[model samples]
Target: MKLFLTCPKGLELLLEEELHQLGVEDTKQTVAGVQCHGDLEDAYRICLWSRLANRVLMPVYQGDAETTEDLYDAVQQVSWLDHIRSEGTLLIDFTGQTRAINNTHFGALKVKDAIVDQIRDLTGARPSVDKVAPDLRINVRMHRGKVTVAIDLSGDSLHRRAYRLQAGQAPMKENLAAAVLLRSGWPARIADFDLLLDPMCGSGTLLIEAAMMAADIAPGLQRKRYGFSRWTGHQKGIWDELVAEANGRKAKGLSQLEISLVGRDEDKSVLRSARQNAERAGVAEFIDFAACRVEDLEREQLPEGVGLLVTNPPYGERLGETQQLMFLYRHLGDKLKEQFAGWTAAIFTSNPDLCKVMGMRADKQYKLFNGALESRLFVYPISERRPEQTVREEEDVVPLSDGAQMFANRLLKNRKQLAKWVKNEQIECYRLYDADMPEYSVAIDMYGDEVHVQEYAAPKKIDPVKTFSRLQEIMTAIPVALEIPANKVILKQRKKQQGSNQYEKQSETHRFKEVNEYGCRLLVNLHDYLDTGLFLDHRPIRYRIQQEAAGKDVLNLFSYTGTASVHAAKGGAKSTTSIDMSATYLNWAKRNLDLNGFSQGAHQQIQEDCLKWLRMQRTPAFDLIFMDPPTFSNSKRMEGVLDVQRDHVDMVDAAMRLLRKEGVLYFSNNYRRFKIDHDALSDYVVEDITFSTLDPDFKRNNRIHSCFKITHKA
Candidate 1:
């Protein structure tokens, strides 16, 4: 008999191979499934042993199904009396529709009518529809002009191993977990290795599947029911023999099981769920569960033997939150090297970009899907020791061309010019160069010991090769001129940003440097984002806040990392409120506040759109408010697009409504063409403090930003 076995889309080939292992040859692979030739015994074995298939179907009839009547006639040719009794319950699963059969519900109803009529006419008894658990579940398919009706032998999807009654936030299906283990070569490597581990194992899906595979236990052993249990052609004698053989093998396999299995997770609640799932799977005695974080995992925690370490870590659904998980991935990578030596590891994640900073090179990768989300399983062979850095100082030092030397000379001149001011003011971060040479169009900034380079996008008229050559020259000149290690130099592109593009991340390296400004310690990520957390050009504005914010209620709008709020808190402000739409940045702001020993109720960090939050306020509570909105924002999270030039008057008016009678409002933006509507706001006083806010480094480019102070006439 011909059989159709269904599985996930990417597992068709694996399912075919699994069928071959069960002594069923002449198999053909199709999209998301396979077709094979097998007898009743072979089909029963597949239902019991095949871990990748979702359903095992036995085709009973084939005919044309151009219309609903055609479908009804096609289903009637299946010999309903030989499959189900006249008084039994039945279900019809219809898939794919032809031109005449446009609706699946109508098609299923016609098929049901045919089966009920045939049974009643032949045996004077009618069958009833049962969706919950049918005695015979018939599957109908309608192609271009043909149909193939089959009986579903597996009552439920094979992925439903009945082991996971509870799961973590996101759980991997049982069949997918089995596929991951197979692709990771667990069966082939089990003899050489003596252990298996999953550091971030949630609900123990992967662990239980591995145990079943190693012990030769049938995945459907714990299932209480099957589609063939009540069918007339079940062949009770054959099924009973297969069950006895399977039980004997299972008893032998479990007695000889020698490998140690361990599962760990940081969340204690999820660990409890995992233990319960393992117990339900009947493999609890073979596995060990613990509540431990990946960061604290040590070499002593494992047994003396080396084995395979597999885990499924949390992959963020939101792109912005992915940047926040960089450190977590890095920590997992660090522990892989520090704890497990000479062991193989398989790490699965939906976001491969976050794996770039894991510090381990993947030896092999397989594309898999966790439900609708596409993911990858990266396999690495852990070495005896962590790999050494390939970069060396001698290799980076090279001769600079004349053009490169000219750019280097200008950099030295700027550093000499600002050295005295930097020393006297105790500055830790400042701009070193800003498009000083037209040929080398890049801005270089110094953040303590590291350097950040932002190359201006070249015009379309320039040659592509020439543009790349100039960038290479700049990279070589910076380290030599500044006497810094080549690895400390991070480069990024600078272009005109729209909407929230300026706030998006550029890389996966969560390298943050701490800098001091006005006696306030702030954290700045120089590599991950387009803009560092602290704006160096706004040095004077932050210093002014520190001087006059004593005993004042402060509010910081469009607070990217809350650097200004930290300044206010350091100056003894009564309370400070920081608002921003990006939760990624708001969390960064909270960490900055905590680093400065200001983690108290006086400092409140809010995640919301600045404009919407301001309009919702009815009380005049703040004494000082800083409003620095984007030049033009069309972020989907906001109600509407924001044009700083067109909406400044209304934004200021909203802020003024929230301000006390004698309070002040400061507005700023980077739109060079921005013009304040002085006439629209005749009721208040607006002072253009653009020049006073520019520090010495940004003096060359006076139009970098615009600042103004607005207050009520007093």
Candidate 2:
């Protein structure tokens, strides 16, 4: 028998390969579908076991239909009584093309009328139309005046898989989720890791799927029906035998398998749904489900082996603001750093900004599509080491002084001509002042492209409006001077304090603002000297974080306006906690939280030093946590320079104290050459989370931030 399998766009190859692997012969791939020749049993097996196919269609015939009469005649020519009995119910589905019969319903009606009329004329009885529960389901596809008719072999969408009796918010389709896992190289015979984890487990699709694969269980075993069973050619005895054989092949002693599989979510309802789904899939015994916040996942002992952690986190488009997502990614990085050492991690996400917040380098990545959204999967290999081993030290890779030198050299080459032109053209905001002194020559301002100026003078006095006006004027003329198109130019002015007391004016500088871009409203903010406006270097990290957050709770510490929180929430974190010290930043975090629709009780905002908060908290807390602190800071409210390197032990200990028994913490610091004091916390386990943090944009700087995961000793 010849059969055609349908799937979403770009997945035809995957399904075709799957069909071949399932023993179907002569498989061919096509746009939006795949074709293969097989026996009725093969069709049944494919319908049951193929993971990537959406629907199986048995093509009955194909012909050209330039008019409605042609379509009706073609439909009547088929032996309708062969597939549909006069007493049975029938339903017709039509997809139109460039034919004269353009209306889908009208075309379907014509086909239905022809079939019924043929049946009545031949047998003196007519089948009833049952749209909801039709005994015979026929599909008609018309494209470019060519019509192909087929019978639907699978009744419902293959994604149902009959495994999920419940679902989490923004749950992923089973087929897509399985495809991601398979693409990630899962189900190794000798698994490198003794565990699989989905921190944002949602309704536990990823976790349940992982567990089933680990146990070598077929996903279709739970499904009770297929469209083929209703076909005239269906052999009950062959299907029964196939089922028996599949049952005989059922994995024995899965309960005895040493691997640990777990999922965590903040929403109890979601967790409940996940539990139900797992039960229906018959893999309930193999998974551990928890209703917990992302900040509370702690590391549990495994059977003396490494494990793999995979997740599909929320993206800002579905869940939260960009800053909030960034905050979630940051905390996810922190949690991975704090826990799950000697583990491999893979995350699938669509948001670039959220990937930046993870603060880890991904060893591997793949461009993929999560439905309509283009996404990426980032793979991070966790290492057993001191947390500092994971930190990316800017000084070691490229010293700040060297960076300053490079900046100066570039400006010097362009400054003379620029300054001369600025003076000649009477360009305002020219290099009236320049930090040319070696100790202070760090700032450069340009008016027009011709005004290649450098400042050598210190800040004795300055004009704000006058400087801005000059810069704006230069911005307007630079494109013209450079012969660049107006649309190609981006002009922005640097904001500064207006008065001495302005520094004392505490306002929420990191509050979320909705900006229209790419046909959607995106939340962004500008505050802090650390480029709160954007962390262009962390784009990869945000993408990775979203991939991992599908059904997990996320914790973002040192959340810094909660950009990571936003990413995690968007990536589908059940809950998130964002912690920082500044009230202004906390308010900013709130704004980000609100913008992402995650400002509900599930997510939390705290204004406190993350270390202190960790110390005051209980253990077995977070599944994923992100901690990225300033390299140096001296606030009157706190102590001296807040060095991440010098204070990593206390910080790790505090975070671990709040981690769940099997959770992860991504501890990171921007301090260049920052080293971990391992001996100070010899009782804990640490793993490097640095290799996955590298971003292509940060090519000049290797160590964007050093990060590590620490967990309790197994």
Candidate 3:
């Protein structure tokens, strides 16, 4: 008999090898399934033992399905009584319909009509369709005017292992899980490793699969029934013997298997589901599940031995959130480096660009499909020490070319020009380079030992090749001029941004350090957001906030990272209210206040939409308020869009309702094309403070931001 075994599209090779290992021979690989010559016993064994197959099918007939009548006629000729009883439940799974059939549903109906009509004619009773649990399943595939009808030996997809009663969002199919393990060589080398860990185990699919393999347990053992068991052609004696042999092997093998499996996830609900799934799979006692974030995952959680680590982390669905996910990749890399030495990791991810931030060089990579998304399983052999940084850190210091030398000279000139102002103002963090040469077109700033580089987005008219060439030169010139390692530089593109765009995270490294500016020691996170937690350009604004905050109540709106709030707290503001929507940065703000000894009462941090929060405050409460709304913001949390240029009057008026009789509201934004509507603010004394806000470093780029000090006309 010829058998057809179907698996996921990308798992054909692995499935082919798995089928061969299961004592099946003469296998030929095809598009979605493999065709092999096997007896009844071999087919039954494949259904029970083959972990990579979705369905084991027996071809009954093949003919033209170019039209609906042809599809019906082809299915009717398969002799329904030979495989299924007249009154038994049946299901027809049709695929690849022709132009006349149009879709799967219509084609399945046509095939079902023919089978039901034929069974009724033979025995005066037609089989009923039972979608939930069918006695027999008919497989139909129509492709290029051809049709192949087969009996599905496996009632449900083999991927349904019957173990997972609960799962996390977007759980991996069990067969795919098995394929991942096989591709990682875990099954053959289970004895070589002491344990297997999944740090981002959403529902323990990977861990459960690994445990079953290690214990030599067939995944099909726990399933209540297969389609063939109810079919008229099933050989009860042969299948019963295979079952007894599998059960006896599972019992003895599990008793002797010494390897352990551990699964950890950040979500508690999913951890519960993983445990439940493991219990249902009968491997609950062999695997341990825990709720812990990947960054917090440590080697101490494991037994004292090197093992394999496998994780399928959430691939960000949106491209804009690349920075946030990058943070996670780097953090995963950091934890793996800090611990898990002499182990191995198989990290599966669809975002390759984000994976680079992990900083681990893959020893091997395999392409696999997670449904339609083409993903890679990157295998890394963890070493005892951190691998060399991907970026060249200790490049040979060579003399600069003339153009680079000229660029270096201008940098020195800028440093010399700003030296006195920087010293007299007691500023430690400020911009040192801002496109000093048009060719560079990158701003370089210093935050202690770090170099933050922002490449200005070039215009469409400019040649991308030339722009990139200049960027490469700038990358080289910055380190040479600054005498810093290339790794010390954090490079990001600076484009026109709105809402929380600049402040939104890129990486999960959560890497923060203390940096000082104008007598204020604040925290800065370089590995996360597009902008470091501290805005270097806002050095003077923070200082101004500090100067005027004495003996006043302060409110900081859109208080990102709350640097301005820290200024107010330090300058002896009676009380401070810092509001922003992102909990990540708000938590950072709370830490900054603690670093400054202001974590205690009266310094409040509220997570709310600033505009909405401002509107609700009708009482004149704050003595001084700093309002730095983004030029444009349309966060989901907001009731409506916030365009500073269009909504400034209404927003300012709302803020004024909370302002004390003689209070000041310092309004600033980075909208380059902004012009204050002087007529709209006729009722207030609005002072243009953009020029004064710029220190010597930013004197050349007034368009970086605009500031205004608004007060009651009286």
Q: Report lDDT (CA) for all predictions.
A: 0.87, 0.67, 0.84
Please provide, for model 2 over 1-714, each residue's C-alpha lDDT reduced to its tens digit, 9 standing for 90 to 100.
789887766567778778877887698889778989998888888777777788888888899887888888878768877786788887888887554776899989988999989989988999988877678789998888788888888877787788787676678888878777876668753356667878888988888777777766666878877776676656789888888776666556364456778787777878888888888888888788887767677775333456777888877662113433554676688788777776788888887556766878889887666778778888888766685665653235422344344443544555454556545534332222233344433233332332222222223364322332233333344344444443443222122322111123222344434532111123543222223333434544554566676677778887766767777777887888888778866776677667656756988888876656776788565777777776665556554446666677777887777777777677777666888777887887877766667532233355656767677787
**Residue 422 lDDT (model 3):** 77
Error (Å) of candidate 1 at residue 546 is: 4.8
Please provide, for model 1 over 284-371, each residue's C-alpha lDDT reduced to its tens digit, 9 standing for 90 to 100. 8999999887877876867878899988888877433443355567768877776677889998998887677688999999988888
What TM-score goes with each of the models? 0.69, 0.55, 0.68
How far residue 537's Cα lies from its native spot in candidate 1, in Å, is 6.1
Which run of 10 residues does model 2 get worst, by summed lDDT? 493-502
Which structure among the candidates has the greatest lDDT?
Answer: 1
Better candidate number, 2 or 3, judged by lDDT? 3
Best by TM-score: 1
Candidate numbers, best lDDT first, in rank order: 1, 3, 2
Ranking by TM-score: 1, 3, 2
Residue-level lDDT of model 3, residues 1-714, one tens digit each, is 988998888898898888789888698999877989989999999888988888999999987769988988988888889988899998999989667988899888998999999989889998998898899999999999999999999989888888998888778888888878877778787767888899889989999999899888998998989989899999999999999999998999789878888888888988999999888888899888888887678788678898898888887775444444666777798788768788888888887766677778999998888888898889988887634542233355456677767777777788788889877877667899898677778888887778887888777687644565466566667788777887797877766687667776676776788987666679987777778888776778888999999989999998888899999989999989999998877888888888889865989899999888887888999999998888898888898999988998888889888888899999998889988998988888999998999888888887889999999877
